[model samples]
Target: MKQFCSIAEILELYEQYGNEFYSEEITQTSHALQCATLAQESGATDELVVAALLHDVGHLIDLAQHGSDTTAFESDAKHESIGAQSLAKLFSSGVTAPIALHVDAKRWLCATNLLYHDSLSRASAASLILQGGPMTSDEQLRFRSHPQSGFAVKLRNWDDNGKALEPPELNFKKFAPVLERVCLK
Candidate 1:
């Protein structure tokens, strides 16, 4: 597994690979910044903001593992699980749990909220097939019981809307302090 010993390491990874396209239009960095901005603007906790910032770090990790040949949009990397597990080393459940559950939250939302699936981006809708589509009733019940389900759902919403063509108002550097503050000491 890819290891990140410090916030600087994480930042460096972003600096190096974040320029890659997240969707067809948005770069990974832009997506991250936009998501974090949404979380912050929504008055989310520092941990949630941090989760939003780094929720897709797994994609970066997978890229690093597979090199440039990896087509991120072509397959399911289990990015949510990969990212959450990696981040759990340095952050509490407040952060990692939401990251871990975010994808399942997507499935849950698609199942529970009738309009949610229709609102998904084209790429997201396609990936939903690879992601097992919407959750079944039993799966939805278990997902709702997770302690971080609400936070994960909130993060999923930000993750969906974060794909903006314009530049983000804040950069990764702006989030460094929050990262440090929330890191396990």
Candidate 2:
């Protein structure tokens, strides 16, 4: 089975997907780079930064095939989960799990921490409910079971910022090297 996508291949996929679906202010590549930058600045592990960079790779596919609206998933096709599954065989759980659970981590925090749910993005606010709604009691029980709960929280926090209305300028070519750095063994 195919696991990792090469840098060139990933870029080709992005080209077909178009830039409009990523963010109005930044290209998909730029948004990813910003997330990676934030993760690195915060002293997260190298793997975490890589995960941050590629967390939304699945969005590329969704937009390519289904278009930009998260609502297109009908609340079931969590891009995070689809992305995680796609990357799982290529990377460690340390990387994939955060990408997968970042959304759920938000819900987990919202359910257990009173100060959080209110601050979610309009899209996230709605998507969170669709993704399981502020974590059921059972979900809370499971979130605490993870060893990297705190790391997932950080990833989620960075994810929120990655969708900035006016993110810093970034070039896709510059981060191209990162694709190789993370993907090849």
Candidate 3:
């Protein structure tokens, strides 16, 4: 796992790769800021809000190594896992677990809610298949058993809808305090 010693280094990582597009519509920064804004507006806790802001940091991290390419997107880069494990060094499960399970949340939704799959964007739809299509009945049961599953689903919703192009109300710099408060030494 990548260890982050300070919020500044994380911010620098964002600066370095945040401009890359996640798909046709959203750049990495836009996805992140939008997700964080959604969490804040929905009255999520400080941990969850920070989790939202940094959920896709792994994508940025991965892109830094490989540059933007379809292979990067197509591979099971397991970005959620990367982000979560890296963050686990600095945060509790309240934050890290949700990030880790967010991909599963999407799978859970696809299994339980038939209509949900229709709502995914083109890129998301493609990624969904790469993410294992949907959960099995057994998978659903085990997934729901996790305490953070609901929160992961919530974050997944934001992650799905967060690919908007408009300027966000709060940018990366605005989340610095929250990052500091939750960041472990």
Candidate 4:
């Protein structure tokens, strides 16, 4: 697993890979900044905000090696889990759990709410099938019961909304301090 030794290293990683095109119109950095901004605007805790910022870090790592292979996005690379594991050393579950579960939360929302599934963008809607489509009733139950599911849902919503907005002027430096403050170390 990749481990960031300092906030600067994470920022450097963002500098290096944040501009990659995500699923649709947004770049990876744009999506992350937008998600973090949304989380902060929604009164999320610092850890949750950091989680929002770093939630897609795995994609940075993955795409570095994989080079935007269609097969990658077409299949479930488990980016959520990959990101959570990579950041687990510096952050608590408050941060990592949401990073781990945002995709599952999307699945949960799809199974439980027709409006939500309908709200999905063309790319997101397409990726849904690859990301395991909707959850079963049993899966939804488990998701609801999970300790961090609420926050994960919040992040998931931001995740969807983030892709639609224009990228902001804010960059990794603006977020580095928040991440540093929330780190377990």
- Which candidate leads in lDDT? 1
Highest-scoring model, TM-score: 1
Candidate 1 lDDT by residue in tens digits, 109-183: 999898998999998888888889999999999999998899999999999989889864667888999999999
Model 1 Cα displacement at 24 (Å)?
0.6
TM of each candidate vs. truth: 0.96, 0.84, 0.95, 0.94
For 61-108, candidate 4 gives per-residue lDDT tens digits of 887767776434777788898889888888899999999999999999
Residue-level lDDT of model 3, residues 1-185, one tens digit each, is: 58666788889989888888877767888889999988989999999998899888888878877788743457788999988887776788998999999889999999999889888787777888888988999999999999999999999988887877775565689899999898876
* Model 2 per-residue lDDT at 80: 81
- Candidate 2 lDDT (Cα, 0 to 1): 0.73
- Candidate 2, residue 149: lDDT: 74
Error of 2 at 146 (Å): 1.6
lDDT of 2 by residue, 91-148 (tens): 6788888888887788898998876887876666766767778888998889979887
User: Which clashing pairs does model 4 show?
Assistant: none
Task: Tell me how far the alpha carbon of residue 138 in candidate 3 is from the true structure, in angstroms, after superposition.
Answer: 0.7
lDDT of 4 at 152: 95
Segments of candidate 2 deviating more than 4 angstroms: 1-3, 22-27, 68-74
**TM-score, predicted candidate 1 vs. hidden true structure:** 0.96
Q: CA shift at 183, candidate 4, in angstroms?
A: 1.1
lDDT winner, 1 or 3:
1
